[model samples]
Target: MTYSASANRYDTMAYRRSGQSGLKLPAISLGLWHNFGGIDTFERGREMIRRAFDLGITHFDLANNYGPPAGSAETTFGGILKADFLPYRDEMIISTKAGYYMWPGPYGEWGSKKSLVSSLDQSLKRMGLDYVDIYYHHRPDPNTPLEETMAALDLIVRQGKALYVGLSNYSPEQTREASRILKRLGTPCLIHQPQYSMLARGPEAGLLDVLDEEGIGSIVFSPLAKGILTDRYLNGIAPDSRAAGPSAFLNPDELTEETLDKVRALNAMAGERGQKLSQMALAWVLRGGRVTSALIGASRVSQIDDAVEALRGLEFTSEELARIEAILA
Candidate 1:
């Protein structure tokens, strides 16, 4: 597909299929979870999104409460859609979620039919789109029945508000329950987004198996482990790194001596492979066919270039894999 000058860089990025689905997603996707809020300059955010698209990142992920004040990320993204991406909507895959606390009272969050339905409408209004490529539950809600959430997803698809449904942060059992309900409703659950990286192997515990059995795709967020697996922390936390940011997701203290030792050892292995620690970490996640793509965040274009370069050195020898496992041990 052809795009404007700002989007011409897409030819450099690789695209991977979402499980058995006919749709293919860029091997790496841009996320609006950070730095694309109402407070951030819309021009910069637009440039980043445009650059990502140019680099073949067709999928953009967002949620109702992505901004610091809530809803601002969606609002900002909506403006970008109207200003630049609306004309090329067919070339993009947009996704938004609803299962988080956004407003007062009980109807604001969770997987209830009322909450999911209302949040989706609000998301479409904020994005100024007729339909999002994917709509997610955001997070599983124990208080709401699984059927209610699945039914709500079914209604969303039927209403043309979203083409496919996704679930985020749901455990293996919860995913199974929701998948069963969605299957019964005839709305196939297409993807599951979770936090997965070499440092965080929680998904490999059982989530991957469940997805394989159910024929559902997996997209991993924080696949770089919030930059911990990167060489940035090997020398200690940088002044402007996420570890120094106010966000609670990444902490400087978590840079324990043990973890740092592991990071150094992993860096040595990456050096032998002629790749950066960050690139190798990302490539590691994509090594298994079970992963569809790695959802990543970046503060600069150079980081984007470096991360994308990792795709060229994704291969690893069996011995190399064993050495990496031993280091993690």
Candidate 2:
């Protein structure tokens, strides 16, 4: 069956500008970090993508090292793009990153000019994209010269490979330095993606402030703390859940009784506000408008639905915010 996007897609969804750039990403964007790999069901990922676009989610985030086997997520996304989204291509914001451990040996990863350039070339090939809307250095390289890394990004933009550049997992200082270098190269940084959720407040210490200073928008990943912020583990880790998987980042040990207590309190508050824990968490991250988007990962189409439904009640009273802080405290 041919996939026709919903006519009402843009009517109900929210879009926020990516920093000082003209690009406005959906307040809720989809991240292909998990569950869209070659090992996963292709039909499942396709349905999720279709539903997301129908719900006005225009930004799709990916990277070369996203899949379990690495690079397969882009391949899966490319297959879907070619099949269902080619006509709507101009309406989407597709971003991919390099800098993680991809292949082996020196040129396979990190921030070297050779590494960054070669990685983006391979990423473009995998995703079947002539150019991504935003390209990022997945992480800062300790040894590589900052100039060389930023220069590689500028070169890619000049070559028409990526429209804008970004950074992920970079510290406040690193971001400032990288932004300065990129600006000097004539391509300013557009966005920064950091791991921030109610459970992970490390960004609050300083990263968000730096992004504001740099005029860089942020789309935070793991805003749900790898599903902990969701109701998926309120009782216990289900067999099908990520926590139970061997490669899972959220192991059962991390589910301390202390943490579950906080989860239960938060869940109760969310109930009082007529939203699910996941929905409230999404709203919490988007609160104050400092963050541009909440990058969510969904294994099912309904998860995506719940995320968009969160926008319906994004506001939080000062009392509610204070109570939340007390609970986390």
Candidate 3:
């Protein structure tokens, strides 16, 4: 059977501008950080992709080292894109990143022009695309010059390997400096990917302010704290849950009673708003529009549905905000 997108796909989901730039991203973008890998079920991943697109999720985020073996996520995504999403290519925003260890050699990783350029070439090949909508330096290379990394990103845009450039996991000062360099290079930074949630508020300290000042947008990842903010663990971790899996990204130790308590309080509050805790978490990060999008990782199709439903209740009352702050505090 042929797959056709929902006729009303754009009717519900909201789009936000990427900083002062003309580009806008879906408020609920999908990230291929976990499920769309070689080790996962191809059909299941394909279904999620199809459902996400049907729900107005126009942005799909990927990275060079996203898979268990690294690079497999892009391969899987490429296959799916070729099979089902080719007709909608122009309507989608495909983004990927580098800056992690991909191979044994020193040149295989980091922020050098060589590493970035080579990694992106490999990424483009894996995704089967001539150029990504956005390419990011996944992290700041402590040993490499900021100018080198930003210039490499600019080169990617110039070479048409990427339409826009961005940064991820960069600190306030680092982002400000890199933004200046990219501006001088005549390619302004498009967006920033940060790990942000009620559980992880590191960006609130300064990163968001820098992005606001620089007129850059942010698409926050792990907005549910790797499912901690969801109902998945309200009772206990299931055998299929990431917490019970071999992956160290989320472990049993992370679901401490203290953390669960906060989650429970927040979950109750979400109920008051007729939302799941996960939906409220996504909305909270996007509350003031300081954050442009919330990048969600869905292991199942229903999860994608739940995430899109979050946009309906994005606005929160002052009392709701105060109660949330009190609970988190």
lDDT of each: 0.86, 0.93, 0.92
Clashes (N, CA, C under 3 Å) per candidate: 5, 0, 0
lDDT of 1 by residue, 1-329 (tens): 33364535566778877866778888888888887886567888887887777777889999999875589899999988888776778989999999889999989988899999899888888888888999999998877778888999999999988999999999999998888889899998999999998889999889999999988999999998888888888888888875676554577788899999999999988998899898999899999567999888877766777778888988888998999999998
In model 3, where do residues sit more than 4 Å from their true spots?
A: none
lDDT of 2 by residue, 1-329 (tens): 89999999999999999899998999999999888887788999999999999999999999999886799999999999999999999999999999999999989999998998899999999989899999999999999998999999999999999999999999999999999998888999999999999999988988899999989999999999899988899998999976776445586787899999999999999999999999999999999899999999998999999999999989999999999999999
Question: Any idea what lDDT model 3 has?
Answer: 0.92
Clashing pairs in 1: 7-54, 9-54, 10-54, 10-55, 10-56
Each candidate structure's TM-score, on Cα atoms with residue i matched to residue i, is 0.95, 0.98, 0.98
What tens-digit string does per-residue lDDT give for candidate 3 at 200-271? 999989999999999999999999999999999998799888677655558778889988999999999999
Candidate 1: Cα lDDT at 48: 82
Q: What are the runs in model 1 whose C-alpha is more than 4 Å off?
A: 1-10
Model 2: lDDT of residue 258:
99
Residue pairs with clashing backbones, model 2? none
Question: What would you estimate as the lDDT of candidate 1?
Answer: 0.86
